[model samples]
Target: MTSTPLHKGIHPVLEQDHPYIFIDACMQAWPDADYAHAHRHGVTAYAVTAFHPWAGLDEALEGLMFWHLSARRHSHLGIAWIAEDIRHAKREGRAVFVLASQGGDFISNALHRIEAFYRLGLRMLIPAYSRTNAICGGCLDRADGGLTSFGELVVAECNRVGLLLDCSHVGKRSSLEIIERSAAPVVFSHSNPKRLVDNPRNIDDEQILACAARGGVIGLAPWGPLVMKPGSRTRPTLDDFVEHIDYVAQLTGSADHIGIGTDMSLGTYPDHEHDPWGEPAYAAVTREYDQHVTADVRSPLRAVEGFSSYPEVLNLVDRLQRRGYGEADVRKILGENMLRVFEQVWR
Candidate 1:
């Protein structure tokens, strides 16, 4: 006899139906991937990151345009500019890929470039990534120095253009300042809690509280390092990932603020010579530092066990329910919470 799956009764419509919205808060679209894969995952929408920290304006456009052209060529893909686009994509059995920029450097101090990309379907942006830049300090920066004067301007511009502000790779101090400054609620687009995993890029209790206080959302990523403890080579389980959801719920007093940022980054650098390790910022990131550092982002670059891709996202609902999350809260954690933010922020 076969045992009943845990999620069957918990989320009856999850595996078979697509009535409710399901989104991947973070999806990578590199030139190397060279195709739209979100459609195959059964996800209703994705916020696609087609950029890197060291990429300049020219390189940034190339990445974004690569997807833009693919979406045009592919019948299954569409660029989501607003919440309606996502809804429509769901109705049409399609997946909408929203263009995103992970680093602020591509704008190169040209504030209007923010809106320019916005017009081209960029709905989200993280002003800094891993290291300090003209806009703000990053999580891996030697000294946070907090948000800069220019960073404040960037926040206002993002708000003005209705770009959803993200603090995933931003420094703690800078992230806090950004959350406080933005008229719109900012997001930790794809970060986990520091207390759970101790990664430098993860958010802390203070950041979580600050974000939740302002009606922001904390999007947890399924990256192995973020889910499992550092220095552990053991395969991370779904339980390990769900513990984070439980911790956030207990800490914030609600699951209203929790969401997924699977960080489903796929593809390689094409070859070793083209690897990002050649960059100065990435070099410092690999260096053993007392304050801000990374623990080999290339160690298999895998997701936690039982959650290898978007199709497996619903497993969280069952895990969460068994862990005692109510149906409404589990829905919020899966996708509703982020969609709520989208309706409020995006034009």
Candidate 2:
């Protein structure tokens, strides 16, 4: 017997009809076999990477099968490691993969590497992440510096290659710096508005306005701290998530500048097990030396109930649809808006 969609009981409309959802902001670290679990709810996975593969390219390729199987019903992909995955996915008729880099760390202070990676299909580059890198500083950095000399070259090269510049992890000063220097539309692929929630990772009103003014789209991530306040452990409800979307809509002057990346590392690790809080398996061990570092982000896995599964995003969307969002708006929020930005900046 077929199981009901995750939103079935929550929303009567979902009981009978589940909307087709194309996820654009998924990570590649999760096991590939898990895609089928997402597919059961009508989600098509578009796997993205941060360019730092643990076992290298060969192992990363192994995850594509999971992406291919869920293609017919759902397909949207990108973010770092794009050259290999994008070409392969396109050839397989799975879906178009949009290349993205989580941080400028991959470039290793060289524009030649940036050029080579772009030629290989790198469409977007995040200038910074959780720490200071060659290009610039991240949100967590003590000083929010923007676009180093190398970062300038990286942005120019991205323009030359038609790759988009992303500022999600870049600090406030850096985000604006990139915005001012970028010739193409820039993105905050998986960030929330600080106006709603006070996280440093979340963008403030000015940042949101700048992104929209440049014709760039801001992908609101559904992760907890960026959107809600539930004591120290409980996850935010769907309403909290919508409030973020709504706040962004008001900030950007339209929903077209807003989209959902979800940042849902679903089927991956729960809150307590993720990085910045968990052991430093991926980054430096000393990064987590202070136990207080993981405080707010730690505990009870703040993922929305029924929303953790990839397919449930559409359920949230449909709920928004009923609340009076036009179909055109829905289309943009789903994937069209991001695609528009991609086509403009990605060669």
Candidate 3:
């Protein structure tokens, strides 16, 4: 399918009239059932994370292979290796699945693995998760050590191979270092604004501006404390989600730097016996780290009512229109902005 030229200031037609490009910049995994649901919801593509801190290289590779097999088995799903793949997915009425390493540990002490993963259709790489690793420090690291020499090599290799560098779970120093060090545009695939909600997982204004200056996009996550104030009894509404998007746009002076990454997995916690990623080993790490935060007080997955399902994306588009955002701007925030970054970096 061919894409219509993107026009600024024009109100976008309804989702049925103009095929909306909805891309989730980061998700833990997309099971077969989820892909069917996403296809029904008109989702163009998703960047699914294959690496977790709890898993070693072997486990990460296994996860990648599982997703690859799943996509091959599912007739409606296609693996996306470049920006045009997204447009193709839209044209074919299919969901484009892109793979990413949420933690750099997937490289397993080998820098060359970055290129290997790229060849395997892995498109994005996060230097760190919530904890520090040999490559870089994390936002939760006790001391904010910046990117290591190895981390620099990872960045260079990722840039060389056209892999999108993600700073969502990286530490402040490392995040800035990634922005400065990489020649290609970077992204905070599924992070919120720290100024809106005081969480280490969220990006501060300084971090947001630095990413924007480099022509990168910040995908506002639809997670709880990230989108709302702490201890608030009210479930996060669509307005709350839009507020974060609005915050990023106002801070950067352009809606072009904002996007969405739900970061929501298929199932709830403690029900991982059937999960593809093994027994949810990350749960133990989170249990230890969650005590210091307010995530339990409010659910991050259900931040926006109805967002737990894929079809609610249409609701988000409606909200954006009501908020006076032009259809052109809404399209950018929805997916075009992320697409632009992918095109720029995946050259």
Candidate 4:
């Protein structure tokens, strides 16, 4: 797995990074079967999404409890209660799991559900997916009503209950409100930069600075279409992904607020390593690319070279070192930043 973009060797110090916490802040879902491979690939902890778009209370509990059961049954999977728990879990040779939800609809306008979920070991919540909900606005809705009165309560409740707030897939207006209102740092768990790809799912400079201003970290996603250069004809390579780290670092004058949120599932397109944009998640963006862009939509849409699976993630450490990032910054981008947020909000 020494496949970094270009030549310079890894920094000698980084080569000995045994106790570092490498967290993938956003993995859409992590089934119990993948726990061994996740740890084998150096995964320390991850935020695994549980519920779906319109999943109500019953479905929500079912989704969350699945992970709880996994941790109990599987020796390789450990449940992380606080940010510090990740450190202990990693030392114990387990891949820690942070229970997360991608949408707030699961709560069904019941704020008490937040506290219940917290008690159940759910540590992060994304309030909205891709559609408008009672709590907040969505990224692809008819209008941008920003965060509503109910959404404000959700934010306060999240703050009180130690649930990490995520803004990915949320509307710009609503995302901004969450960033400002949160007493603790926030996260865009699985988003890219709009300057690179121009997708609505990607955030702009204003959003970037606002998030960073409040001491938050934005996880850079490796999802092909989201971070590929605007007008690019090929899929995102290791360098293509690192280019984003470069872009955001240069944009903010620091790498303290950046991390990796893979936003992908390992072994998804197994037969086809470079998966096509045919999944339900890519629906809206694919349509927009096909209709508005220069018809390069179906150009094998990631049917070319790219960062394909999870086990290949260590290559990123190589890539960042090749790109001249120092050890502390690279560590922050890898997992420390997310840990800092969790500790501050959850403690």
The local distance difference test score of model 4 is 0.75
lDDT of each: 0.76, 0.60, 0.76, 0.75
Model 4, poorest ten-residue lDDT window? 5-14
Q: What is the C-alpha RMSD of each candidate to the true structure, in Å?
A: 5.7, 6.7, 7.3, 6.1
Model 2: per-residue Cα lDDT over 1-347, one tens digit each: 14432321111112322433354553433442243233243333343653442223333233333333344344443232333443344344333434456766656655776677666655666767666677777777677677688877877888887877878878888888888888988888888877666776778888999889999988877665565552334456677788788888876677889766765543333233346655432322112212322343222233454454455666677777877888788877876677667667766
> Quick one: best TM-score, which candidate?
1
**Candidate 4 lDDT over residue span 1-347, tens digit each:** 43432211111112223556788888745342444445555678978876665689999899888888877777877788998889887777668788888899987778999999899988988888878899988897878799989999999999998889999999999999999899988999988888877887889988998998898989988766676566665555778778888988988889989988876553232222344765334325644344433233213233114444444455777788888888898789989999888888884
Report the C-alpha displacement of residue 213, candidate 3, in angstroms: 0.1
lDDT of 4 at 218: 92
Better of 1 and 4 by TM-score: 1
Q: Which TM-score value belongs to model 1?
A: 0.86
Backbone clash count, each prediction separately: 0, 4, 1, 0
User: Quick one: RMSD of model 2?
Assistant: 6.7
